[model samples]
Target: MEKPLILVTNDDGITAPGIRALIKVMNKLGTVCVVAPDSPQSGMGHAITVNDTLYCDAVVVDKDAPQKEYRCSGTPVDCVKLAVNEILGRKPDLCVSGINHGSNSSINVLYSGTMSAAVEAGTQGIPSIGFSLLDYSLEADFEPVLEHVEILAKQCLEHGLPTGVVLNVNFPKVSKEGIKGIKVCRQADAHWVERFDKRVNPLGREYYWLSGDFVNNDKGEDTDEWALANDYISVVPVQFDMTAYQALNQLNNWNFSQ
Candidate 1:
């Protein structure tokens, strides 16, 4: 039996420590091929570089590493499209994205480049998973989450994902022993309350720094936020379809004619 062709990507750029950690674990699973952004595309939600010349270059980061790698000057979604359409030339057996430097739990999934890559793969009928740690530091330790990532990736490869589904895995920032375990959960209801910090530059010009606090309003025990709070690696099965089918008939009866 041939080794599964595994497509790996991340929003944190190919050189980011998070992707390096992801690559290490993926190498154990199968033949890994990476097509990730040339630079960080952290909050780029399913964006594609359409109006510009997109390019991909073969790069050797870790000369000792076994898998072939390429850096793409595009968004996370673009990387997936390029990989499937141009690089791989055939759909990969599995696609795993991230080991991201920050949490992509709850509503954050909507804006995450990490999850976008996996979502792109899922849209193409490929089994996919996105991994993230709660820590956002560039030097955050990932040793503890490696085993969990391996387990989830292997399970996805073996059992396969349901059509139109992708896994979103988020780990709490803690040690290996501190992690309780894994929980299959739903996305928690959350929102970011944006705030702009007004500041003055050296030239006395005022500027605003983008800032926000994540507010989780969901109290459901089965939510990803709850799982993370309890020190568990939360795995939420996500889909791209955003239709509110239940409200379709309700909206049709609204007083639009009046």
Candidate 2:
């Protein structure tokens, strides 16, 4: 049997240690192809380069790097689109994004380029998974998530994902005892209590720095927040469909005939 062709990508440019670690692990499972950002693009969400020209160039940073690696001058989503539409000779068996340097649990997924890449792949009918570490450090240890990622990726390749859903896996920063295990859970009811710091720059122009604290109000033990708090890797099945089925019947009663 031919080795599974895996497409790897991330929000954090091609050389980030997180992606480098992910690529290293993926290379062991199959033929790996990477098309990631040329520079850090954290918090970019699903934005694509519409107003600017896009560029993708072949590059190498490691002696042990995958044979097919391209750096993209676009968002994480754009990389997936390009990889599927132009780069790869055939549709990849899997698309894996991240091993990201921070948590993408709960509402963070809305602003995550890491998860966006996987979400884009899922939309394109590819089995996809996004991996994240709770640690926000650039040098965050990826060793803890390696086994968990391998198991999940292998399962997806063997079993395939349910249509329209992709996995969002997040690992808590490793402690002295290391990661406990995996927990399949739902996203917690959470929100960021945000504020902006208004200040003046050197040019005397006012600017604002966005800041916030994540608040989780759900006490449910079956949520991603709870799993991550307990030191287990959390896997939440996420779907891109934002339609509210329950609201359809409620809105249908409104008078619009006039």
Q: Candidate 2 deviates by what RMSD? A: 1.2
Q: Per-residue lDDT of 1-258 in model 1, one digit per residue for the tens?
A: 899999999999999999999999999999999999999999998888889988899899999999999999999999999999999989999999998999999999999999999999999999999999999999999999999899999999899988889999999998999999999999999999999999999999999999999999899999999999999999999998989999999999999977
Tens-place lDDT per residue, model 2, 1-258, is: 999999999998999999999988898899999999999999999898899999999888787655589999999999999999999978899999998999999989999999999999999999999999998898788886787789899999999999999999999987636778889999999999999999999999999999989999999999999999999889999999999998999899999998
lDDT of every predicted structure (CA atoms): 0.95, 0.92
Q: TM-score, each model? A: 0.97, 0.97
RMSD to the native, candidate 1?
1.2
* Ten contiguous residues with the weakest lDDT in model 1: 45-54
Candidate 1: count of backbone clashes, pairs at least 3 residues apart or interchain: 0
TM-score of 2: 0.97
Candidate 1: where are CA atoms >4 Å away?
Answer: 200-206
- Estimate candidate 1's alpha-carbon lDDT, on a 0 to 1 scale: 0.95
Give the lowest summed-lDDT range of ten residues in model 2: 58-67
